[model samples]
Target: MTERATTSQPTPFATRQLHPAGSADVPWWRDAVIYQIYPRSWADADGDGIGDLPGITSRLEHLRDLGVDAVWLSPFYRSPQRDAGYDVSDHRDVDPLFGTLADADALIARAHELALRIIVDIVPNHSSSDHPWFQEALAAAPGSPERDRYMFRDGLGEDGSLPPTDWLANFGGGAWTRVTEPDGTPGQWYLHLFDPSQPDFNWDNSEVRADFETTLRFWLDRGVDGFRVDVAHGLVKDPTFPNFGKHPGGLMEVTHEAPYWDQDGVHEIYRSWRTLLDSYGVPERIMCAEAWVAPADRLARYVREDEYHQAFNFDFLETPWQAQPLRAVIERSLASNDSVGAPATWVLSNHDVLRHASRFGLPVGAPRPNGIGADDPQPDAELGLRRARAATTLMLALPGGAYVYQGEELGLPEHTSLPAEARQDPTFARTGGLELGRDGCRVPIPWTKGGASLGFNDTGAAWLPQPTSYADLAVDEQTGVEGSTLELYRALLTIRRERRLGLAALAEVEGLGDDVLGYLATGPDGRQTLVVANLSSTPIALPEGAQVLVASGELVDGQVPADTCVWAQVD
Candidate 1:
């Protein structure tokens, strides 16, 4: 426990008002560079071998020095760790592994003191089955009000033995799991879009709706600036459930067409939430949706004026390192958000995906699996790191907000060869080795070069083992090294803020090869920041009369080399 000390009103940490290309005034969030802190792997204080609130508080200076306007913390609420804290059993409090309620209050106060706005993860699509509401649903009768909080339906078999639907969990296995009645007879089934320990909440229930509102206010009152709404499009399912009737559904959101995702009804909920956020007024709170819909236009709906403030631009992240497709995704994402009067947000990696460095190095023609297991072919480390740095330059040069995952600045690659015994992701456990799990990306980040846990904790212990390779990429090792990814990122952020480049209007520039990507970010004062990326093997000519601000690699005379990106100031 700790004191939540009040501090003098801090400088604008979250956002700064800006108008680009004659557009509406944009809030600070639109131009902010937000760092995503995965608490479990960030920094372990208290020698518990797990990252906690105090650890994050101690590291606030790292974020401030990195020039991030805000920090988006992944879920750390009380849970069974079924989905690595996404399956919240208690949304109002912190889990003991992370810290206490007083610790959270102190963390928020510290963030404010360091001039960093806080955006916390809010999982509304589901709750841990161990949650009180779900527990009550299990003990109550079929028609009881307790059952209404979650998706519960009667089985169709003669003895009601079969599942209510054939839908499969996103993590694998049947979506519906049946429970036994109090008297030991067969019982109804409950839906879990994820792991069995996580039950999908019924958004149709008024109580469920009101309960999330309470959770939102609880964090906002504690001084959190906003929220990253998890699975934002997966709420408000189709009432007909038509897709599930004739067949057992096992479709992934490969096309974003799943019945459980992107329903029109979800918009109303966000609109109501926007209203709630508006009432808070000062320091202007915001909400971002982790919606995984295809087509930029559809994703734009989540950020409409009356709905959420921003939605993660994931299409760009999944796009291959090809210039044409990458350019298209960036253009489409910005255009779509512009249509909604909202700015787009860019991200290269997160807790769930392969690090871009490794992902970029995979064989261009090989299969792109979610997780790369031990037996998978090793990526071209040199090539991948080069492209990753180039990609980072392109990402930061584009208009709108950006998210930097923990350790990304250090150029930390995913530890793809983790021993099976060290894996803890529920997907890995449930799939029974059929699919490699996200444990690779979730490995605790290395802070220092030496120590059993890479200086993550005082006692050198960790939930996930750090690879020997991590020593070279540890924060301490990369911090001041010239041409290091960490230094590259710091320079990028400094330039981004000093030039207001994040709020610049992006437009295509001519004269680059088809395999090259070129765009100009026009500042409000008419100066331009031109970004040219050479995705091609051959060199590409840079714009004449431009002054280079920074580049991912050394330039050869006036040409941008293959797998290199440059930011230049132009008239």
Candidate 2:
């Protein structure tokens, strides 16, 4: 078996099949834990109420303690802030609000010093409407070469008055937007799946493809390890743009289906990208996709050996906290990715969704109808911390790459409210207020409990309000506490890195009870770890012949008493 050097000293033996002695070492991404940091909300320095590169640099020690192998920062490019930096107005330069290019360089250097690789978000499928390229297309004459950069078609009706297609925008509006010609003549329309402010680039156009390649090269040259591509599956759409016929249920399909959604040509595009990435001398650099589609099998295509390294496995996010349903989703995800020789990435919450505490039927502050109310009895802080540890143990023991959303280590709960005026997400406004706003999960990080604004900043106000209860959960407050959730994460991460337990192969996963979930991970070295989680309030008996290593709740006779989980080394 082969061995790779790690910064930490080795301790316990964990089963891992070291690659063949002379074979090329597997990429660092495999079995690595990546922490996602949303730049705007992580930490605010300079009293700007916005997190910047400097702020992130100041917090490297916190991330280092978390034991993550890498950090993935959300976009920090020049933008109009239409989509919170997702709409890139300039790909080469860092947004002044976030910091300068020099600041980014400092961030990279600092992160590496902490033994953490840095990956940035890249949006190749579209650009902000305010981007120069879009402006150029607007200025160029209709049917001109520049106009072809995006899909531009004339009206399709008999009277030349109707839209070219009935495609609905993913953000709930007409996908096509009309633009008038310079001479006041009826001009062409364009396609935008997200917002009208974000126009989709036509991959059919060679010029558009070349421009994106240049963008990729720019970042690779800048020393960014890799990218998390946004809306990757939406890059290539059906060329025919066929309208779906009426459904048997007599309802018009509001959303586009995946079969026609992720066009076959996308494979060629990703293959080309893989070639470019290889040419950069950074072949193992990570490339993950944010793909939302049904039937996990179809989504596996995005990560075929020559395509992306990994794509978001959202089955866990959509599953209820119940053990049976969660088990089914996890098994399906494992089976689906195994077929394609691709690794899966698991995440339960992100900047785009409600926090797990609320999603899992736990009381937020009080009791309401959704299993736990704001006023309903609150679970003890210790109980919450135990559950958080149990969840992490289960996630880390799973046979795949794990993604931890920012601030989850503290067991942070979702914010209850954000004034209507503070809501910046277009989805909330576009849906006519029907959707629960994502602003709740996007609250600012709590830096310290003793300071104003939870030490996130000394400024007037954070972009979003800090959660009221975060003071007790701040990093400073939990770092020294033995059983704190933050410390538990550090321990898990240390084990993953030192013993390399993350590289273990899944031996068996059974005992999926109504409220209990269990699995075993074993390496070729005869080391094994058993992970059992009590997902519900009721306690469950632990399996026999297990040496308890780490646990949540009380332990009795080598088993977790109840309402807790135990991570043990099987004898």
Candidate 3:
């Protein structure tokens, strides 16, 4: 058999076949750091106290300076402002409150010019009840195809006394909404996983699936790089509508059927959308899922090559400020995703959660009666800054991509309290005001020190109150400081780009300490970088023989003193 033409070395063709070019080169998504901007609170150009597309466009340079490769803008689609714009009445046009469609186009153009890709949020899981399609369904004859677009049925018993199934809405109400048909029937019901105003689309219906595909194409045609799919796991629901059984408190538990909601068949839907996006000929376009599920293995499925490019790994966001738990989550995430053929994406906070500084103990202020207060004193602020920088350092040192929530770079803490009437989050209302509303985290970004609403806008009160102390933390104020969080972020981002970290490589994490975390990033070229973070309240000694490339605090002889992080070139 001539030994299959075996030579001293394998032929190039054989090697190529063994490791394809597509497998070798990193996806544009892997090494990129995505900055998430909540449009309603990012910046306001019109003095309306609401951030608009033009406002975002004007701030492009600031984002560029931050060293982010892309920006993920939260939904600005036309809506009635229910659920903070997640209820979309139209997917194709920009909301008039945010700006005109022309403004969106201009923002995209300018973003691309700055070499930053823009990804918009797409809410395919549901639409505002005010949407034309929903209105038509509401008036359609019972059992008509239009009504089938949503989950609708007659009341439970012949007497129409109960819902078909007992399921709780995420917003703390019955998931099933009673609706009177055009004929004035008293027992009709519709399924809405969230607010009644946001009806869940029936993905089982082929028409609904096709409509989403069209929606994806709509944005791709309009020059959007990709989508941050809202409630990606909520698209599919159990056809059986099984009851989740009561909670221990007997509050009529309803989320038990969640597993069925994120069915594997949903991949077929995502694949179809991916196919359309691929046809658009955009390079490095990405799709990320806002999935909240268990079994890291199951979450990994959403980011497989055939599904979304990435899924937000929210474990860190929920993890408390403890070293052991944090390390375990990171390790498990790396292991699970590596085995499942998907890259992990890390985030400390987002529009829905409390800011990192507050969550992680960065000085914001005393916890006021309404949850408002300055962080701790300067020492506490410095300690918090150290932790924030360390968190990012650890995130970047990991094997996959990392996400930076807007305003996080400034060590921004959550602002929980608002006047009783100004609070708009449903979480608070539904929980009988027990839940700390998310409005604080949603405050407008402070751009300049005490300069006209922190330069967010030239208007009255912002949609959410601007933090009174923002004057000190404004970007203009911190930009000049040598050891500011902003500067640390810039340095890390530059290092990420210059190093060309691939998504597939497993990081060798080690050197764990009681008040510090450390790891090493190893690339295909055998290059290695050492990362160390001080998780303590005071300064600590740094490792030897490592050249300091980036440090969150002052560097001393290639060492990072306490409450700091340093990225050192190992080889």
Best by lDDT: 1
Q: Model 1 off-target regions past 4 Å?
A: 1-25, 244-256, 365-367
Going through the candidates in the order shown, the clash numbers are: 4, 14, 9
lDDT of 3 at 317: 59
For candidate 1, the lDDT comes to 0.83
TM-score of 2: 0.87
Give the Å shift of residue 507 in candidate 3. 3.9
Instruction: State the lDDT at 39 in candidate 1.
Output: 95
Tens-digit lDDT track for model 2 on 1-571?
2233121223233322212111124677766788999999888778888888898899988888788888999999999988788888998889999999999999998998888888889888788998898999999987888878877777787755677777776666677788877787677888887788888888889998988889888878777788888877778877777655332111112213632356667789999898888776744677888776557887788888889888887666666545777677776777688778776688877887666655544553332221222343444555545555566677776756788989888888776555666777776676676544577777887878877778887774688777578889888898879887787788777765654565655533443456677666554354666677777655455555667777754566555654566678775
> All candidates' lDDT scores?
0.83, 0.72, 0.72
Residues 1-571, candidate 1, lDDT per residue (tens digit)?
0122121222111111222353335578878899999999998888887899989888889889888999999988999887789999999989999999999999999999999999999999999988999999989999899998998898887878878667778777888899887777889898888889999999999999998999999998889999999988788777766445322222223434666778889999999999999999977899999988877888898889899888888888888888888877876787788888888889999998888888889986465666777798887878988999999999998878889898888888888888889888887877897777788888888878988888888898888888788899988898888898888999999988877887775666645768888777766555667788999999877756778999998888778899999999775
> How do the residues 1-571 of candidate 3 rate in per-residue lDDT, one tens digit apiece?
0112222222211110100011336657865688999998888888888899999999999989888888999999999987889999998888888999999999999999999999999998889999998999999877889989988877687687698788777766677888877888775688887789998888889888887788787878888888899888778876777777432111112222353356666788888777777776648577998877556777788877767888888765566555676666776787677766667788888887667666556333333222333332222445555566777776776667778899988878676445667778775676676655578788888988866688888765588876576678889888968877777777778877676553323333334456666655545554556666765555555455567788766766545666566777654
Candidate 3, superposed: residue stretches over 4 Å from native: 1-24, 245-260, 362-383, 502-506, 509-515, 536-540, 554-563
Pick the TM-score winner. 1
Mark the regions of model 2 whose C-alpha exceeds 4 Å error after superposition: 1-25, 244-260, 362-389, 509-515, 552-558, 561-563
C-alpha RMSD of each candidate structure in angstroms: 7.5, 5.9, 6.6
